[model samples]
Target: MNGNRNSQDVVVACSRGITPGMPSFAEQIAKSAPDAADIKQRRWIYIPYDRYTDRTGPLTEQSAAATGVVIVESTAKALRRPYHKKKLVVLISNMRHFALEQAARGVSVLYVFSPKSHGQALVDVQREHALPELTCMTPAERELRLDLATAIENGLQMKFAEDTTWASRTADFTEVYGTYKPGKSYVMDRFYRKARQKTGILMQNGKPVGGQFSFDADNRNPYKNQIPVPKPPKFRPDPITEEVIAFVGETYAQHFGEIDGFDLPCTQADCDLMWRFALEHLLPHFGPFEDAMRDDHGQLFHSKTSVLLNLGRLLALDLVRDVAQAAEAGAIPLASAEGFIRQLLGWREFMRHLHGETDGYRLLAGHVPQEHRRFTQEVSPDRTEEATKAYASAISKADPYAGARPSALGASLPLPAVYWGVKSGLHCMDTVVAQVIQEGWSHHITRLMVLSNLANLCGFSPRELTDWFWFAYVDAYDWVVEPNVLGMATYADGGLTATKPYVSGAAYINRMSNFCGHCQYDPKKSTGPGSCPFTSLYWTFLERNQDILAGNFRLQMPYNTLRKKPAQELMQLRARAEEAIAHLQSFKRPAY
Candidate 1:
């Protein structure tokens, strides 16, 4: 589809930009091969008409066939970018695909997909040479569409070809955001109304209604009085998703992430179905139990829209609007609308802002001490020892299944024993993630309160915890999950995201759901013999993080609770909690 005439040897220059029309992943793989034959691993990086972007870098690095290509982890690595251009380069790294949209505007083009050190990998191509630059760069789509032009121009060796991939990174940012005033009441009103109107969410005396907003109070109520709602129906698979699943199975079979059967609603039609299930089944009572938890059923009353929202298959405004509409229709109450809206507008946007600032590269730099918990290395229960062996047949890792070392701010916290006692306390955070990889789903509360709260309370490194959030959640993106994990959830990034760390005891879960009643631990006790893990862990957490949290204005009340307790008794409580966590499975659940 590209205008470039293919040569015997096509070399996609080390590029810093990406475009949409470049061949599909499978096709790119075919193109990469000397014979242009079909190969697998082609579709693991593939997204359909929908662009697959992670914003940090391109997807395709080298051509293996006329239709086969290789996935590049990041544009900087792909281009072998230099130190001076590093910061600016990151802005457009793998997110360079949209550069092609600009190319249609008639801008000068000089493209390289990788560095000269990689040799003719991303540069010029000779028509008959063994390897030429017929190469196409695949960066994440959002980067080109969203990042500033100046940022895209940072690391390139400027030269011109009749090339038409990226028109130019020559636009002005001031001229763009300047067109619309952000903080005006009218602007806010319009965005709200637009959200309402887009989703037909709130209808009033005829037209979609306004104000009387956010019935979140209703949503905050616990759902223990109610019955458990069933999971919505799943769409088995369409040809596209089926193909993707198959491809991931063969090629990425060994990749860190999981590939469940095609249960994800990838198409717009499927998303609508999933949305309808939420509205008809989950909405009316969704708010009251939004924050509640179930033992194994993680998504109690929570909106199941994350999978749809992040994939571009659905819009945020519509989602919030629909909840508003449901409230107005009296189909659901106001509290539900308010609570869900807060998640979409308030928290969703907040998370996106957080992602724009950080994406986890800093934590991956091996900065954390090895003494920290090792997840990647831990062979997941899900992986067979044989599969694990084969997966690691080539990798020379100290622990083949081990994950990257966690940062001081993420998993390296000094949690005391009492806090460590609850199975509910900083659960096998990594274990659940391994499950998520296999299942492709984790309810909001599971994500927010379960893993997130546990990690936060247990003193996991904020950065490592944030990375786990990104890696585990299907709906997670830097723009969506970063702040939620880094700021609000973990209180990592040192409190820029939340007012206070969300910490609680078994009592909170007891009050919220039926899970405590079903547990072997007693929700009432702070001491022993199957004391609710939440209780002892709560105290244990307070003891551990007290020093770091002493200056926090929001932690005043909890600190007071800790102060009232006698020191010796506190020490005994903490001791038990620590022993509990190290051998979490050994503890029996006491009768509720």
Candidate 2:
């Protein structure tokens, strides 16, 4: 913790920067409150939220003992982006529920309706409480961290404690990677191996269990229709949740997705139930079909525990131990156990470290253009409605490449209507986008191989794609989406987080999923009306970016294959690709 020692009156200010729904910090303070109350300089606590802002933190019995908690319905964060209706509802409802829970427990709660910013609301809170000093856990988001600093600079005596929610810290990342080096890319496998050794997870006698660090090879078998996919555990909405649904429907009518069918786990009991269900029903088959995609199945034996983990309802360290114990007991396969552990203990931690280390890749010049405007700025809140309308209108009147990123290779194609749930005649793209719009969730394979793969291949702006992901997904945060989109998916970082761009053609999609069977275009075709857009665009993408990508050893095979194609055939494919691009850009919403 960093703060002034002289200040007699200090209040803890908990913001929804990360671990939104957890009551860990509040509980810690509450346990010490009785002892501190005897002293003249007793420390108070405050938790604040804006109405239309984001997801709310859940309240527990311990948090109900807090001296005071504040809730504000701020217009600043609500209109920050046109967040999904369901997303807004989830946040506001959870907050309202928490506040109500606290009030019922006899905790003094200050629920405010502040139309301004969170910062201004904090100032109002300070005046009401007559608190001279404020301290909080360091926020996970870079912007929110800056906001806290600004508040301190602007006269609020503020201090921040180290955020201990995540398994790894910035110091751990620095100890592993050393100082930031430009143009240096760290591989995930190496980092994962180190993490396993350090944490002593899956280790025996100083060696990895099964004499291997990764079971990724064993984890890739496509679903052969042998095993039935398990449906995710669902919870019926209670009165509190129902009220949130009605409130969101009225307030954010313009936001995306339906407010009905809200079945997410909001409390500790709900999360516990979901976790048990995953361990029993999903874990056994999760590893083998982890990357497989099925049109008929959405969950596909995957654990939908990300929301719970991120919200602090479930601890990452605890979950890892549970998985390890289960694996040792022979309840779940080693491959399944190891794969799931790698996600929480490996990729998830790496993404957070990479997000902070890269600083959104702003520190690395020439990877992406300096003048590239953020999508949020373009759709400013003042003119958000007009900007959205204009974007829709422009999609109809413009070329696909009109607003694409103007990088060295000129991948300047504006995102087409297809990404916004408009049918693009391609079954894979249509299905993925529709699912995202409806549910605000998709398994990683669908996101990477299908959604991000097509975006990278088609030259959609990386920043634009990242912003779409930020607003669209329920579990998305700046710390996760940036590296995933720009680094792993789009290769916008010029091969930093990912060794190579995760771009794929129709062949990869056909091999992994059942989508091709329903598509109007043939996955095997590379030209003409029947040609799959992904097939044509794959070649065009390679041909256009050969200057930058031709030297990559991993891409040599695809380059050699492109070299063998007849000149006439290549030209026809390029023409077909342009036609496909135009069709996607036409802004004509197709009937499903």
Return the top candidate by lDDT. 2
In model 1, which runs have C-alpha deviations exceeding 4 angstroms? 1-214, 225-231, 256-260, 357-438, 551-553, 584-592
Q: How well does model 1 score by local distance difference test?
A: 0.44
Candidate 1 lDDT score at position 587: 48
Predicted candidate 2: what Cα RMSD to the true structure? 8.6
lDDT of candidate 1 over 1-592, digit per residue (tens): 1122122112332211223454432333332333321222231122211232222222333231222222222222211111111111212221223223212222112233321212122222222222222232322222221221222243322221121121111121112223212121111223344444433455465363435545554555566546767776767754334443443243223333445444555544566788888887887877777876655555665655765555444566666667766777788767766667766765554344333323321232343233344333212222332333323322464422122232323446533222212333333333344345445456666566656666555565555555445434455544455556655666554444455677777777667656666656677887767775556767877777777676788778878988999988798778767765655444452211
TM-score of 2: 0.84
Tens digit of lDDT per residue, candidate 2, span 1-592?
A: 1122110111122222224354532342243322323221333333433111112222332344544444455544554555666666666555655555555555555555444445555666666656646545455655455544555666656665555567777777777787678778877877788888888888999998889999999988777797887778778776556655655565445665566688887655676799989988899788999988888887798887876676555677777888888888898899999999999989989888887886756666654453254443323223233223322323453422122232433454677778778888889888988888888888999999988888777777777777778777777767787777777878877777777778888998998889999999899988886988898899999999999899999999999999999999999989988888788789963321
- Candidate 2 lDDT score at position 491: 81
Name the runs in model 2 displaced over 4 angstroms. Answer: 1-42, 46-73, 99-109, 366-410, 588-592
TM-scores of all models? 0.59, 0.84
